[model samples]
Target: MTSASSAGPRRVVVVRHAETVDNAARIWQGHKDTELSERGRAQVQAAAPHLAAYAPSLIVSSDLRRAAATAEAIAGLTGLEVRLDPRLREVHVGEWQGLHADEVRERYPEVVAALDRGEDAPRGVTGETMAQVAHRAGTALREISDELEAGETAVVVAHGVSARVAVSDLVGLDQDVSDAVFRGLGNCHWIELVEAGKSYSEATRWRISGWNLGPWNV
Candidate 1:
């Protein structure tokens, strides 16, 4: 297993896309193609310099508008082509796609219960399962790690849920640690991953190479 500590500076930077208007409204933006809010754009502006510090060789993000826009900004800063990868899309919430937490609890308590059951709940409205999201995200991550050619660093911009899940899979995190990875990452926050030997490791292994250089509170 390649340890990050032994890999020098070859790293992966996991970044949460900038916030959207829906985030400000507390609405579920899963799979929504909402544009970045003005604040979201500014957040990305603030974060660009920090991200450019990586001098990333490649930048990938969800094809959805919010994520795509965020990726575009970083691409501009680093001059790396922004590649839209569908596997990095946000987990589809189906019926709960646009609903707030209170609305979900009030109208679909059963669906929420299913979500808490440690499995992907069926799309009460039209959603994909967490299991499905994990499958695609895990595959994409592995491909980036094992297939990256000539690049010393690659950056992936993703959503909240899948970001935690992907990192959990990479680091073999226990459930609690995996679940709480979100605590350290905020909107437009950057987490650095160091690959040791051929094995993978989490951002905790590195210094705050870059951080929540955004205006939003995550």
Candidate 2:
């Protein structure tokens, strides 16, 4: 991620949704809308105190259940209302949505190739392209930035891919940088960003801000 100049204390905390059954099964989980596992619940609770410290002025979440549940906890802790935006949902993986990565390679080679190319196209099944998903997320982020410009500290609860891509755009990371960092979206992970003069800036510049330790149980 590249750095930019900023003038205010406007902060944007982007987080990945907590763990879910898909994660436990090693499935793709994109657009599958799975609920969080029991351990996932604990992870959310564990993040509460840390998030509360931020005392966010606004909280935005993906419309998906897993992300919503995670964001709900942050909202409860920070005493902020969480707003749901469907556009912030994870990229649809079509036929690969609920399949394990191996399964995708074994059963849907063509789709797998599409995924590798990072090209937005319809896979074996109906799914939105990477470009489509990225565009939606980028738009959502701009909305969040606009909110920040109006003087609000925001926390955005979203999926890993969407978050990664959005962060890539914000930091102007090239495909290689984005792909390397986006090997996978860390569950309940975070990246801190602040606004500068006319654009948003990243605090760490190129790294994600937080990590998840398996439901916070370990």
lDDT winner among the candidates? 2
Encode model 1's per-residue lDDT on 70-168: one tens digit a residue: 888989987788988889888888777778868878999777777677555665557776567777886786677654443378888888776666665
| lDDT for each residue of candidate 2 in 1-218, tens digit (9 for 90 to 100) | 22333433567778888889888888887777799998788778877667667768889999999999999998988778889999889888777777787887899887667767766566546877656777789789767866654334688899887887776666566645677555665787676666544335244332333433233432
Q: Which stretches of candidate 2 lie over 4 Å from their true place?
A: 1-8, 117-125, 149-151, 181-183, 197-218
* lDDT, each prediction: 0.71, 0.73
How many steric clashes does model 1 contain?
A: 12
- TM-score of candidate 1 against the unseen true structure: 0.81
**TM-score per model over all chains:** 0.81, 0.81
